[model samples]
Target: MTTTTRTIPAIADQIVLVTGGARGLGRAITEAFLREGARVVIDYVTSADAAAEIVAAHPGRAVAVRGDVRDRAQVEALFAAGREAFGAPVTTVVNNALADFSFNGDARAKADEIDFPAFAGQFASAVQGALHTVQAALPGFDEAGSGRVINVGTNLFQYPVVPYHDYTAAKAALLSLTRTFSADLGPRGVTVNMVSGGLLRTTDASAATPDAVFDAIAAGTPLLSVTTPAEFADAILFFASPWSRAITGQNLVVDGGLVKD
Candidate 1:
């Protein structure tokens, strides 16, 4: 059977929204979209200063709005702020907000030490946060007649080398949502997908990781270097670009060949 899809707007014409866009990988994703001439709406729970800096740097192209993605009302307000900024609703969304987490393995609770509450906390942000954003963006997506939803994920689900029990489990659930959402929304002119990255060389989240851990990950990768937030951001742009119009429900791993899928 053949499937039909709507024509996605060019990046220049798209108004983009990035959750947690003030720092780390989210910042890079926001910048990448802006560089492609897309008007960007940056969502931040904290990091107001960083968000302001980005807005100042980009001038008219970017605006930062504060919101907690886990709260459905806040998420809807976040989109409303975006609509007010650019005179149009967001046509593309990157669900990149993460609950507070640090990548230092030594500090992480061991699987046995971690509890259900830990898992629940992560799910509240990663899974539910994404759900809220998608639901909030639906009306906008319907208005535009085309949309792109790219959920940030992790390579750990495939390899589970470090087994960050709570964090990894939450991301695993997010990947499932990415596919299911794609199926339900594809015909309606929305494409949902995921971009999973390995241990990024450096980000506020990974700063706590020791240098040795970074070195080891680099050595293991075919590229002989750990991926950077900027590198991963490029792949995120692909899913939102015109090139990815017909592709959905798939996860593209962007970890420099660390995990083959």
Candidate 2:
């Protein structure tokens, strides 16, 4: 008898759908996937020009689609559009779209000051959006009998450094969904996971964060530097690869060791 290990599939063989992939951390993730030869669908609620540029840069390997993840119809249509453009089903889905937000700790609402509307809005974007995408992608997963779902998360739930209360709460719910979804989908040959990142050094959301804060974060981290969107994006790829076939319902934090968990 001989024993052999399964190797991860090449990115070129995977068709991926990335939400909010037109800019910020999503852009980095899309580019990384493209570089690895993956056929990518960049889903954007706005940022038309940015999405166009990414598609242009990648030529036939990438396409940009407009969709609001919070809207179930739009999400379904987005997946349809991807299939139409690529002539293949999307085997991987990355839920990286964030609700509109700025990382200005000074301007963030304190717990007592935060309102129900704020929480509701974040939940719509973080939790509801994931639900829409996952539900939309299920038929594809069923047809293929295999699929990958990588949800973008945040380290703030574990290490509430500045306590962006609403954002953190929504992501906490997303983590719960990650676990439950994995359990439900595991038997079907689908894997669900999360890649949580601390405040990235330079992204549109974090652009308002003070330079001093970035420096302080770098000094405290084991890596002695603030993590970049590109670095965080790389961690997302691991969850989507065949190497992670047996690993589901896990949250991998990519923040230069800022949070021990």
Candidate 3:
């Protein structure tokens, strides 16, 4: 079978805000937007050096800002900083910031060991963070007459191969918010969607994952290879471009066919 890829036009005119964009998948997403000619604000809490490096590499195209997405006040400041730097309100927001946690499935807490606070923290970062960003960006969206929100998610919510209960649960809730937000913002010309990825081969969060796990996951996938941060980041651009104007309230899994859904 022959498959052709469609090129998405550069979103140079749009100012983008990416939470947790200093490192890991977030960094990749930030760079991807920059390469597409978009001005990007890299929001980070502790990865200041890494964020600075990204800004230095991209020069005028990217700026790094420190903010905690779980805090509404900080989220507002994040948007404000983006506008001040780029002289325009952020037209696109990617909720890619995750709660500080490693992806070592073997060390993860099982159902019995997990508690309410665990779930609460995850929800705070996954759901509340998105909420704060979307709320902060509403005015801008209203001004622009359109907006795009791409929520970063995971395939574990579907396959649960590692049973990362808290992480997966939080991501599932994020997916729910993505759809609900689409419904509420659709009439306003705003679109909300999710890009779910499986166990990425390597990232700060996934660095602790054993090599055996990666091999197993790759063997199960039809592509016989793990997905890269760059590949997953590319899928996120689709939702922010004109090509996806008609698409919303949907989840696109980019795990190299590890999970069919």
Candidate 4:
């Protein structure tokens, strides 16, 4: 089918859903969209208080819903909740949910020690979770005649600076899905892309990272700084905005120039 012809909506006109949006890097992404005046639906499996507080802060522009992205039924309900709150279908979706994981490389299982289940758990969160979200968002996209899918990724897949194997592998799979989904959905005016960031300086997931590791990453980067969630969120905004209308199936790294590719 030919992509329906329509004007790209401004960021303020978009209704956005961010999975795992109550805390950490996800919270940063949620705030970034709201700052642009977009109505936001914050999805969380926990962190209800945090999510509610965010919604309270934004008044009518933001709402929080609890759902697990790995489940299809819950994902559909998430969209319904968004529509109920905003009176519009979600025009953008940010699949940023991650399973329980920490960034302490010292505590990580080496290749020989890491089990298949570890990879499976990560895949469920990173790849399967994204799959459920995209599938659920498809109807809304078809209805609106356009949509944006921004998958949160990691720079480790490219650089493997610390090799958190399972987590990095799952993100890599998600990237492959990003390109394929773009090809399949582009005809319907949907764009699928990824924004990969390195170990964010202070996200909950990265809290376990030692100061020396952080400093080393900063030292290795051309900018001599570790990427922050807010900085990474800015790139996510770029993909969701009208300026990126023609771009799809691509990965943009926002790691302070640490990974050149």
lDDT of 2: 0.92
Q: Judged by lDDT, which candidate is best?
A: 4
Question: Comparing 1 and 4 by lDDT, which wins?
Answer: 4
Compute the lDDT of residue 165 as modeled in candidate 3: 85
Model 2 misplaced regions, further than 4 Å = 1-8
What lDDT tens digits, residue by residue, belong to model 3 across residues 137-195?
99998877788999999999889898888888999999999999999998788889999
lDDT of 3 at 93: 96
How much does candidate 4 score in TM-score?
Answer: 0.98
| Regions more than 4 Å wrong, model 3 | 1-10
lDDT of 4 by residue, 88-204 (tens): 899999999999999998999999899999999999999999999998999998888899999999988889988899999999999999999999988889999999999899999
Determine which window of 10 residues in candidate 3 has minimal summed lDDT: 1-10
Q: How far out, in Å, is residue 61 in model 4?
A: 1.0
Candidate 4 local Cα displacement, residue 56, angstroms: 0.5
Query: RMSDs, each prediction?
Result: 1.2, 2.4, 4.9, 1.3
TM-score for each of the candidates: 0.97, 0.96, 0.95, 0.98
Candidate 2 lDDT over residue span 1-261, tens digit each: 753344445577889999999999999999999988999999998899999999889899999999999999999998898889888788899999999999999999998898999999999999999999999999987777688999999999999889999999999999999999999998777889999999998999999999999999999999999999999998988888877878999999999999998
Candidate 1 structure quality by residue, lDDT tens digits, 6-79:
77898899999999999999999999998989999999988999999999999999999999999999999989
Question: What lDDT would each prediction earn against the true structure?
Answer: 0.93, 0.92, 0.91, 0.94
**How much is 26 displaced in model 3, in angstroms?**
0.5
